[model samples]
Target: MSDRSPAQHSDMLLFLTDEQLRQGIEAMFFAYQGFTADPDRILAGMAYGRAHHRAVHFINRAPGTTVNNLLGILGVTKQSLNRVLRTLIEDGLVESKVGRVDKRERHLFLTEAGAELERKLSDAQRARMRAAYRDAGPEAVTGFRAVLEAMMDPNMRRKSSALKESST
Candidate 1:
């Protein structure tokens, strides 16, 4: 019997066939669809796309977050995000105001209606996540989280970890 760390075990199993990789790719595609299914339905009735949903969600999560901060979080180009933000603001869902200390910076917040919509969208996703987590069980849930955290880019992991720490 050989004793190897979990990382070493994963490294040793790195040789995968084309079929295996194809299966993984298919699984990821399906998983993404499943993840988006509920939100897609909700957005369909509202005439808003995933970009609006994402902006509302992050604004709800961190009210008064700066535009630059959101641009960083979403990893989207400034022009792209500006279009979404403009639409959301015009639709009365998001409120963007010049920063008190720094007039050039825009801080974002969700209105009452915006918060309601955000809650509805989040509830749908949470229901899906809850069911998947329950089906996967306690051990798999832990390992799944670990693997996802490990998969994150170094800077992203730092930001994610910081958010987790702050929320707790």
Candidate 2:
């Protein structure tokens, strides 16, 4: 707790200039575009967009999540989510069933085809991430993840942490 002097800490804070911050912002934009490129191509073939990918990803991550839970996680309007859900269900990629204990609640699950698609999409992204992480090295990867977590809203951060915990 008493390692660094005040002057040293101030010097480090001053190192992050406005221009440096802007560069970091631009880097993030390009990185995100590159990250999504492969999945975009695959989704384009199926006429689906990033929304569909997100829904599939989250549903695969949480097999028995409810629509209300998804809505909270996704931060999308009911109408918007309904449109995406409808298409996925119609395509047989997602199956929604009434909750056994709560008749009014709809629980979402990925069908076999849906799981296959999720695997394909995730595999592409994971490969890109693996390569990026390898190139960045472990220290940079840890910093990158910490920065990402810090950028998330408090509620989203909690949700992300919960999901990470559950997956493990």
Candidate 3:
């Protein structure tokens, strides 16, 4: 809530020095580490990895999403995602159903155990984000989100927007 207008803020970004950009990059790296720390510990105990956590999260978000759709969202090689999916399927954490319309398509869903794990992961992340948002105040929170959205490429931004729209 300063006296500056949106144009002033945009102009200010134009003058960011190399050191400023470097510092911002480092901050993002450290912030990501902090954000993932809790989930990493949880995954370690379960003999899982971040890839599995990501799959569980996205599947929970859009139950019955197709494997091809997931591959697009995750941008992982089919072989890699298949390995993770295989493990999850074998562990009884995820369920895959053959598509009725297209027999070749496989839809993914989280089982009860997967849902529980997703809850734990989400709760941990939400707690951290809640505390940070509280400390940063509403304006900073909004600005931070805008900055993040701006950083994404157009394709990713569209995908992100679609997911957000679906949630609402």
Candidate 3: tens digits of C-alpha lDDT, residues 63-101: 888888888889999999999999999999999998887
**Cα TM-score of candidate 1:** 0.84
Q: Could you give the C-alpha RMSD of every candidate to the true structure, in order shown?
A: 3.9, 3.9, 4.6
Local accuracy of candidate 2 as per-residue lDDT tens digits, 25-120: 999999999999999999998879999999999999988788888888999999999999999999999999888877878888999999999999
Worst 10-residue lDDT window for candidate 1 reads 159-168
Which stretches of candidate 2 lie above 4 Å from their native place?
A: 1-14, 164-168
Candidate 1 residues 1-168, lDDT tens each? 545665556436578899998997787789889999999899999779999989998888888888888888889999999999998899899998888878877889898989998999999999999999999999999988887897789878876765320111
Ten-residue stretch with the least lDDT total in model 3 = 159-168
* Backbone clash numbers for all candidates listed: 0, 0, 0
Candidate 2 Cα RMSD after full superposition onto the native fold (Å): 3.9
CA error at residue 132 for candidate 2, angstroms: 0.3
> Cα deviation of 8 in candidate 3 (Å)?
9.2
Residue pairs with backbone overlap in model 1: none
Ranking by lDDT: 2, 3, 1
TM-score of each: 0.84, 0.89, 0.89
Q: Which regions of candidate 3 are displaced past 4 Å?
A: 1-13, 164-168
